[model samples]
Target: MSATTAGGEVVVRNAQGLHLRPATEFAKLAMATGCRVQVRTDAGDANGASVLELAMLGITQGVTLRITAEGPSAGDAVRRLIQLVESGFVV
Candidate 1:
């Protein structure tokens, strides 16, 4: 397993947060960051860039997700991802 790294967090504000479409889009955007990204919720944790794993987080509209990325571009990755999630996963 990779070492646990600290990044940032974003609270979900969308009325229909983290559903299929938004999760899918978030995963795609995260993958494009070229870093290992993961998301953590009260229930569990999962790969941030994987649609299946993200969906498994079971996040509701008002839930907060802790986002972490590790590797060379981890900072940039987290920033972009935080923005995406904060924007209701519109990206």
Candidate 2:
């Protein structure tokens, strides 16, 4: 398991932050990468790659989340995920 440090901060723009649907989608994307990802927020920390943990964060619209990805594809994963979040997780 190769590891690297990747980080970014994104604001929740989707009127609902990462709720069930967005979180699920985000999780699915993370899973596709087969890398370990984690997210941190003022509310708490979550397994960035897990839909369940991400949903549990209860992130609300306008909230800012600090995301980090570390694993074989850490750089790519972090970049894409940040883009996802910035794009309102549309992808």
Candidate 3:
């Protein structure tokens, strides 16, 4: 079988934006899904599983991000990730 790819757009809702804590949370979630995730903005792209990489993107609040995931559970991974961001990384 071949791996599948899924992607969608998600907006940052938190006033603080993708700060250290939220970036770490997002990376952890992406890593746990066992999928290769990538986040892209008009500025550039970064590995979704790496907190440092995500932070480097400098994504701010209200920014619409394009997230893509590739792996056996790509679709679910993408959906969950989008939900995470849209929900403001609720703790």
Q: How displaced is residue 66 in candidate 2, in Å?
A: 0.8
- In candidate 3, stretches whose alpha carbon ends up further than 4 angstroms from where it belongs are none
lDDT of 1 by residue, 1-91 (tens): 3433459988998888888899998889788877788899998998988889888877888788888888666777888888887887664
lDDT for model 2, on a 0 to 1 scale? 0.82
Per-prediction CA RMSD (Å): 3.3, 1.6, 1.1
- What digit string (tens of lDDT, one per residue) describes model 2 on residues 1-91? 6677777788889898888999988888778777777889988999876888988889999998887876776788878887888888786
> Candidate 2 vs candidate 3: which has greater TM-score?
3
Task: After the best TM-score superposition of candidate 3, give how far the Cα of residue 75 lies from its true spot, in angstroms.
Answer: 0.5
TM-score to true structure, per model: 0.88, 0.88, 0.95
State which candidate has the highest lDDT: 3
Return whichever of 1 and 3 wins on TM-score.
3
Tens-place lDDT digits, model 3, residues 23-81: 99999999999899999988799999999989998889988899999997899999999
Point out where model 2 deviates above 4 Å: none
